[model samples]
Each structure stands twice: as C-alpha cells, then as structure tokens.
Target: MGTTLLGIDTKEHCFEAQFHPKRPLLACACITGEVELHHFDRENRTHELAQSITSHSKSCRAAKFLTDSILASTGADKFAALSDLETGKQVWRCKLKAAGYSLLALDTERFAIGDDDGGLRIFEGRAPKAAVSWSENTDFISDLAMGVDGTSLCAVSGDGTLAVYDVRKSGEKGLIAMSDFQDDELLSVAILRRGTKVICGTQTGVLPIFSWGDFGDQKDRINGHSMSVDAMVKLAEDSIITGSSDGKLRVVAVHSKSLHSQILGILGEMSAEYPIERLSLSPDASTLACSSHGRPSVQLWSTEAARRLMEGESWESIFEVPDEGAEGEGAKADPTAAESDDDSSEEEQPKKKRRKEKKKGKKNVPGSNAKQHQAAKFFAGL
Candidate 1:
C-alpha cells in the first residue's frame, strides 16, 4: 500500500520538499513565492493542473531535487533558481549574498548552497555562479549533507555547530565536530555512513547519537520530543525514522535505543491540525513523505506496515544496557573501591567533627587572629 500522498496549499514559507529521483512528482515551497509541483497518481490523487509553479519574490527558503529532471529554488530574497522539471523553465538566477537556508543536489553538475550568513556556495556550469567555497556561522545554516563521496560536507548551525567539511579541502578542511547545546539550536543532520554514525536534532527536544570516529559518550540519547526534531531517516544500517515538532512520528533503533515504531495522527487532519515539518523516505525504504504545520499537509506512509511492526526487540538486544561500572572482573576495582571509601572517609573524620560542634551556629572565639580582629573591630564601630 505505497503510492499515496497529498498536500498542496502554497500559502508560503513551506521551506522544502522534493522527490523526482524517478518522478511520481513532488516538489514544494510556498510563502507566496511559490514552486509547487505535486502530481501523484495510482490513486494517490493530486493534480491542480499537474501542480503549479512560480519562483522567489519573497518567501521560499529552499526546495530541491536536481537530477532526474532538475528543480531548485531558494528565497528570503537572496533568490536562487533553476528549473525545467519537464518545462518549468528558468534555468538559473543566482543572487546570493546570504539568503539560502540549505540545498544540496551535488550531482547533476554540482549543487550546494547553505547561507543566511554561514555561506558555503558552490555552483557549476552554465549560468551558474557561486563560490564562497566555505564559511562559518554567525546565524542560520540549517542543514546540509553531501558525503557519499562528493568528498565531504555536513552542516548544521544556527548556533549549535556540527560542521565536518573537506570537500577537496581549502578552508573548512577537517574532522570538525562541534556539538554544544548551550541553548540548543541544531534542527537536523544525518550521516550514517563513513566511519559510522552521526545523527542530530535539537531545539531542545533532543535526539543526539554521535560517534563517527572519535567517539565520546553519545551513542544514544533520544528523549521523547516535546517539539523540534523536524525530520530524519535512514531505515537500514540500524534503522531510523524520526519526525517531531509534536505531531509525533518514530521508528528509531540505532542498535537499540529502541522505540521501533509509533505513528499518531487522526482528526482535524492527522494529529490535531498539523505540526510536523518534513520527512522523506523511499529509495526503497518503502514510502513515507510527510510535512505538517501551517501549509504542512503532506502524507504518505506504510513502509510495509512499519517494517513489519519494527520486529519487536532485537534492535541489537533491545537497546543494550550494561555499562555502569561494567560489572564483573571485580567491576574494574570499583574506582579502587571508591578510593578505599576515601580511606574509610578519612577514618570517620574526627567523629563527625565533634558531633558538629553540638549543633550550634555562632561560636568561633577560641582566641587570637588579633583577638578575632579586635572583636570584629569592636562590633563594627558601634
């Protein structure tokens, strides 16, 4: 029961959505600057004239899908354009000084852009012009991902950091991995390949899970989203499929932090009148496409019945749980028996300091530091 999807309301500021890697069509963005492109079929209905179109004049933020036909859009006024998904026409616009949010096609002849200050240009061939190459935050730069061999790139900043550049090295060359939650502002990032693991999402409602080589304490930590997770999807090398902003959606399994399935929404259009942002999965993960919150009404899901109800525990042994003093081998000497119980607590500390001076509070005149500084200067110059 796959082919099904709907959502078309171009009200404006719809940020992103794209799928045409083989066309059943889907493309989005609206904040008035339009760029709609729905097309569903096989009973999955949608076709307001094969889906409308327009381009930045105001709010678009980002929209992608660069191969299998071509499409791109960005806004907030730094404009950006490329079209021709079977005759939409535009071909190129480029204004950029700082106004993209995030977009990475990285194929169909190079494509990458992440702005709103943290620049990161890269545009290639015909009418294309952009080349900041790399830059680093002062504010927005929501998300970027390209490293399946496009060399490298994985961004996420709006003040939370998560870089990792090295796209043929020049400036932002590194193993960059900064993750500070200070006020929590990451939003999203996913890189499950090379080395192994890197998933993030914040804005308070957490979903960490780092460890892609350097390792350090975070191989799992998902605290029931109260708001903000926006989207995530891997579905294989250990499964993953999140979405939050409270309209809830989950499938996590990261070698078992468990929660193998969940989906709730119904009435007033699934989940009390919208609130999800984005989510996509279907390169054979079955099919899932969602979007909610305002002009957010896109739906389609059924990854073969949630991957057969996520199979019940085996997410590597139901989220493994064995590392508190790692029991056995004398529990690694229990911190030296907790430092010999701090040497039997310094041999019971002077019998608890003379029973705490017999429970009193004001008594310190056992003589001379210049007679207690002359009795506190004779009672402060009374």
Candidate 2:
C-alpha cells in the first residue's frame, strides 16, 4: 500500500486549505484575499471551481468550512469573518485592532482568533466582545487548533511557545508553559492520540510531543527534517500530516498502542524547489492538498493507502497515480528533483465540458450558490 497523487488545477497559492467535515468540498484562502471553494465531483471523477469568495482586504491566513455551507476565514488585515457558503453573503465579521493571523471556528457565535501581537481572543459570534483572551510574548501567533475535548484550545507562537487554554478556567497562566525547546520558532501545533498529547513542529524540523497537562518535558522528540514546518494537520489519532518549508509531506507516526515514534516516510513529497505554504486534508483523510509558496501550484495527495503504510506495511514508493495505476505520479519529473518536485513538462489541456449535476428534490444546502458557477479551473489538463 502506498500513496496516490491528485493534481489540482490552480494558478493560485493559498495560505491554508481545508476539506469539509462531511461534504465533497475543498476550500482555500488565497494570497490575494480571495477564498476559493471547490467541488469535487466524485461520481464523475472530476472537479470544478465552485466559487471565489472575496471579502478580506489582505491575504487570508486561514479558511475552514464550519459546516458544509458555513465558512470562516481570518485575514492579515485584522478581520475574522463568517460567510454563508450557499448564499455567498458575509454573515458576521469581527474587526480586531491587531493583525490577526490565525482562526479556529467553534460554534456559530464562538471563534478562537490569534494575532501577530501574540494575542489569542475567544469572542462570541457577531459580537465584538471577548469571552476569553490570552497573550504570551510579542511573538506572532502562527496557528490555532482545538483540543479533542472541544472546550480547550492550543495556540502556537513564533517564539517557540505553546500556550494551552482551558475555557473552563479563567486564569491567565491556564496551567502549562512548555518553553524549554527553543531550537527555532514553532509554526504549527496539533493535538493527537485522542487529545492526550500535544505535538508541535518547529522551524528546524523538530517534532516535539508533550503530554496533556504536563508540558515541562517532551514525551518523544522526532527529528530528520531539514527545514521549518509550515503547515500541519491531524491525519489520525496517532499520525500527523506535515508540510514544511522544503515542500515535503511526511506522515509522522507518534507513540501509540500499535506504533512507536517513527517517520513512516514521505507521503506526497515534491522537489524542495518550492516551499510548501499550506496543506489541507479531508475529514475522511482521503484527500490532501498542498499549496506551494508563490508558485501558484498545488498537489492533492490521496493518503488512504499511505495510512496502510503507516499501519506497518512496507512499500518501495508511495507516488503512484490512482486512476492510471501508473508507477510514479511524477514519472516525467527529473529524478534529481528536489524534495517534492512534480511533472510539469506536460502541456495544459482545454477545460472539460460542464457536466450537469444530478438533481435532488431536497432543499438546497446553504452553500449551493457555490455550485452555480465554476470560478477557477485546476488541473485543467489532468
């Protein structure tokens, strides 16, 4: 068992892209403040650009689909907005004074927003009031993720500090401050192993894990990456999918009942020529999208088989194509390509004719406006 590479046709780079929890949808926040939502036609084995949402004034750092129809995005312009995916209308927008860089959608009225000035604010929906606010050093808060418990959250800082917050407690300290590992600034943080452990990726490719409530020492420290981790998302309870400055996607296996600390190997690594700016994974963990820095190029990887490999299977290569059953997805790529190179020597093909979708009599979902027009075409030739 190995990995399959899905080539997404796009000429835009996103800061981060995410798949809907229960829908066949992919949404990305682009560098130009335009959020692109894509619909994957699984029945037809095709995809189309569903909508291009332009609401932010600056580059959006994070975009996520709260429901199949509701989307949330945080921009560098110090604004966090919630949009109705079906109607394409901004439902609520929060304007912060500091430059906001990260966001996590809780419920309709609650969100965890991180800013460049090292501020993490939990505010009610549509209301400009803060319920819980936490700030560490002046380091920029790069990313924010919810703990498995649903009430607690973790905020990773540019100063290599991991701030844990339990909404139940109102103290400023909140409990633990893991500050020993300062090899480089931490960029991404993810809680794994059923929310019992906290794992973070650092600038120098260091993956450190801390037990819940006790962040004084690392439970396990895995190494081998030569660049900073730029994007990370949880693939499984014990597995983490990471994209780094070197454009490499790795399945880092943490300690668990069936596995030890291992680097299971690369999932969808391209040439290190272009650093990976953002990465997204489907709720089923079937699809993975990795965006490159300034190249306007992205790769969608299938991790179904890769999970098998992580489960202790051995494979020579995980770079096969799903439909063609080809030996290598990047077969035409130079063998000497960098960490995550691609097959870019091919010519672009004309757009595929629009296929009429299957009509269902049920009421349209909230994000149906996204289905009316194909905003952008990705992997037009694939």
Candidate 3:
C-alpha cells in the first residue's frame, strides 16, 4: 500500500513532527509541551520509543533537528530550547520577549525564531544574546524557513508580508527585502532556485511566487487547495508538496525546465476534521513521514512512487493503488481512472472527476512539519 503507520498517538494534540536529517529518528512536539522521539526501524517496519522530553512549560509549536544528537524547539513558553536527544536532556535554553511560534535552524551554531507580536530573532550558538531582532507592524510570524545556503532566512507574517533576511550581515543590514503580494495571511514561505523564486502559501488557497530581492507583484500564483495552506515541503528543487486545512495533500510542479509549474497529483489525503499536522522526509528522501490530528501520529509512504506519479505515471504503473472493495475492511482498490484530456486550455488541473467524487462522499483533516529531530541507530533502509 506504500503506507506504514508508526508511533502511537498520545491524548494531547501533536502540533509538529519531524524526521532527523542524518539519523533514523522521528520526533514530535505536543500541545502539552512534551517532545517524543522515536527510532524508526526500516528493516522491521516498526518504531521504538526513544525518549519523551518535557522541556517546554507550554505547547511546543515548532521542533527541528539540529544535529544527529541535537533538537531545537519553541512554543508558547516564550523560550527556545536545545535538547540532547540521546539523553532527552535540556542542553540549552534561551528566553524570548514574547511567545515563540516558529523555529528554524539557521546553521551549525545559529538558529532563528519567530514570535508573537511579529518578532524575528536570531541567536548564535548558546549565547543568550539575540544576535539580531527585526520586525515591522506585521502580526505574529506564522512560519520561518532558511534558504538552502543558510545565508538567507524567509518568514511569513500574520499580516501578509513575506520578508527575506540576509543573515550574512548584522543589524538592520540583514533586512534584505519583503513583499506583500496578497493582503491575506501567508501561512507558509519557501525559497526555490537557490534564492531566485520565493513561494508563499496564502490563506486563499494560492501559492504566490515572488522573485527574491524584489518582492513586488508575484511572478505567478499556483492555485493550490480550497482551504488555507498550512504546510509545505519542497519535494525536489522544482517540485513541492502542500498540506492544507481543507484536508488535501497536493504535489505541485515548480521551476520546471519549461518554466511552467502545475499540480502533478495527490499523494496521501485526509478530511477537514483532522487536517495534516506535519510532514517529514527521510534522510534519503525515500520515505515520507506524515502526521494528522485524530489519525496515527506518523504515516509513511514511498517517495519514489509519488515522484513517478508526479511525472504523469499511472497508479498501477507506479504500484497497486490499494483495493478497498475486495478487502472489505482495509483500503479498497480504486478503479483505474479513465485518462483525461490533459489538453485543456486552462492551466489549472481539471476537477471534473474530483467534483463528481466530492458530490458522492464527505469528509475533512490537518498538515506537515519541515526540518525534523534527530537520534540513534539510523533507519536501516525502507
């Protein structure tokens, strides 16, 4: 089925989940400020609980893997903390002026944090001093992402600003550029093509792409989902996957060789009632780990197949689509859909069959986490 459910869900809601970059580790932060770390055993297809940490006093909104043995987390507690995953010990803690909402690891010794009141702070190593702090009248920062080079940082604000900071310089010099392409809140921001094109997932179901250094009018807008886009992860340099509150996971093509981007297909999906909470890619980019409210804490699937499907391959051509009718209880195998006239003039993917299916059934769900946690015993091939 190309899917595996790992880790048991706790009573408290899990706000974020991540997979380690260089280790076989999966971690999640709950509303109760509890951080759970697990070891994924690809050989046995099982996950073992590695540690449960109570580092924050309140909800841990964001968590990212810094190193194989280090994790960074922030929440309503108004502090950012680094913990040793091996021992589940709090190694360093830095208090912010306001509640922390987003966290991004900038480099080996520097990390960035976004807070309520529209604040963005940068810290170097364990020093308590904020190497830099900057913000305008923007509302709480909804998301933060570092450029592939770690030399630039991009942040989305509650008000609709997508700002990029050049951390290479200190003080106000670091404030590079910003764009308010749409008035609606931008829930997510991602840098593509090194730092040329910046994409933001807006509240209005659109992914607005802006050229770096000059955030004027958007270069293009990718119509994504019906609901607010809550999370996104770059699948390949030119491809991305988005999770929305409307309960859909979409694979969209970007930075195409022809310079045209479009929705490739849907990977995994859920309902609005339990929107996806987080999405993590394994170190090898082979397995994708996902989390959603009221569902399993972790869901796994093959990235290779999703990639093939993105290239316009068929379900059977990729793998079995999962037959639910024959099994009666488990996922039923879906009938192979008739090929569509992809020659439609509209650039948008057609929703003709989707509209019909929608009229036939009803459901809802939540989103994914990017930049995950780390731990021991690397996931040995899945």
Candidate 4:
C-alpha cells in the first residue's frame, strides 16, 4: 500500500501546492487569494501551520519558493508578489497585463510568470518591471518548465502549442522554437531525459513528446492514462509521476530510442479519489505532495516507501483491485480495511465489470507480463 505521511485540510479549495526546494516547508495557493506555509516533520509524520500570507486580492493561482526564505505568488487579480517568509511581509509586487496563471522560478534571482493573455515575462530579482517579456502563445499559458541548465524556458498553452524561449536573449531573438498546434490542450509540462525530451500532458490522456531543438511535431505519444493528465513531475531522468483526472497517481517510465518514445511500464500507483490538479516533489526527492480539484486538502506521500515497494513487487500486483470475494478476506485480515470503503466503493463494481468485459471482448494482448518484468528490472537499476 502507498504510505500517506500527512494530509492537511486548508478549509478552502487549493489550486496548487509546492514544496520548498531546500526545506521541509510546503506552500499552498488557495482560491481565496491566500498563501499558506506549513512546516512538516517527515520522520514524525506531523505538520504545523507556519505562516499565512494574504498575497493577492483574488484567487491565487500559483505559488513558488524563489528562495528558502522568499515565497512568490501570482493570482487571478493580475498581480505577482514576493513575500519574506520570516516577516510574512510582501516585499515586492507588480501588476501584469493579464491575470497570472502560472509561475516558475528560474533561480534565486530570476523568475517567470505566464498570464491569461498568452503573455510571459521574466523578472530579475525584485525588479519594478519585467526584464524580458514576450507573447508567442495565442492562449493562456497553463504551465512552465525550465531546462536543467536554466537557460531554456518552455511553456505549454491552452491553445494547444508549446513554446520554447532562450531566457538569455530578449525580444524576438529570445523565441527559440514554437510547436505546431496539437489536437488537445496542453496543460502541464516537464523536461526530462537530460534535456533531450520535452513532455507535455494534454486535455486528452495522451502525453506528447517533443525532441529538443525540434518542435514542429511530436516525436512520439504515450497513451497510459484513461483521463486527462493534469499535472506531472519528473522523478528521474527516465521516470515521471503523473496525476490524472482518473484520480490516480502513477509513476511512468519513458523509454526513448532513436526517434521514438514509449512507456516501459507503471512502476507504482496510488489512488486519490478525485481529479488531481497539482503535484510537487520535495527537493530531496523523498516525498511527493499533491492537491486535487475542489478538494480542500493536501496529501503527502513517502516516495521512499513507494520505491521500496516497487522493488519488492510489480506495481500492477500492488495496486490491483481484488475480486469482490477477495476483498471480504482482506477486510477480515485487516480491521482498518473498512477505512478505504469510501474510495473503493464507487470503483469496485465498474472496475470488475470492465475487467470481465475486456477478457471476453478481445484476446489478451501478448507480452503484457513482459512489461511488468521490464518494469521490475528498471526499478532494480534505479
């Protein structure tokens, strides 16, 4: 079973939650235009409210730690502000041309924000204005990702296009490449495979893969989820954890060859029971934090536990829903099994029926277990 270390009830809908890059602190952006900071003790499995900063007048769409001591946030109010964590004071604020929808910190001194009008601006330090700004996307930018070296900036947009920029340049010179329009809206993005691949999650369940320096078309696609992949975070060079509208968190391995990329297998999974909206990995990569749409809580899971579990057994065997008869035996064996009734009740019947229908409708695909074996071998290497 996936080990849930902690859960926090914010009493309001949370749009995003992010962990500090170098601290045990978690910041949450709320629909009320507020930012809450919490300090967590992972070993003790406890979390306490640290500080609450009223950073925006309207819904705060995103919040990120520019430094261990500085919290930056952007909101639907069309403003971005930086807050000092020690004093809980707003040190810097700037108004934008449109409502800020996404934010990314390139480094301690540089940060970027994407707006509702397809505008993107990069600010240096706490400058009164953006040092560089551009509008290459035709719609709102949904997410932003930075290359490993921090010079290349990539943004995915609702217009179904991906835009890459050279942050070191300004004006038209900064625009590195723009992708052709995709069929589905791009919601989230991540740079993986040592900066050779750019993966974008779409409105559909598919993940479109773009090769570095080549953005005209996707090199490959991975259809691993049944619903929209709303959020994702790279866990390793070849692995990423994706949160989907299907209400499941899955660790997927992306294997790339000469010109194609495919999913090796799902290494681990945990059910959240709601559409996941945001995901964040701890700086140490030992914990994962996530928030779901319309849910007033944030959940933290132990990544170490997940890794150990995958090393021992296949992900499919670990998370597979048992037959109804087996559930009764499981409940009898573990008294606390009743606690999961709420999550499993709605899915149990339909899932079983679907499994039966799949078995009867078509011949089982060959080499299905080969993926599982490959996943086991991959985990061993990790």
- Predicted model with the maximum lDDT: 4
TM-score of 3: 0.79
| lDDT against true structure, model 3 | 0.65
Better of 1 and 3 by lDDT: 3
State TM-scores per candidate.
0.31, 0.77, 0.79, 0.79
Q: Return the number of clashes found in candidate 2.
A: 17
C-alpha displacement of 325 in model 4, angstroms? 7.3
Which regions of candidate 1 fall more than 4 Å away from where they truly are?
A: 1-34, 39-51, 57-77, 80-96, 99-177, 180-208, 211-231, 234-239, 242-252, 255-287, 290-301, 307-382
Candidate 4 residue lDDT tens string, 73-162? 898788989999889888999999998888998888888999876789999888899999987666678899997766879988776777
Alpha-carbon deviation at 277 in model 4, angstroms: 1.3
TM-score, cand. 1 vs. native: 0.31
Ranking by TM-score: 4, 3, 2, 1
Please identify which of the two predictions, 2 or 3, would achieve the higher TM-score against the true structure.
3
lDDT by residue for model 2 over 72-145, one digit each (tens)? 78776788888888788788787776767777878765777787767778777567566777664346677777
lDDT of each: 0.55, 0.64, 0.65, 0.71
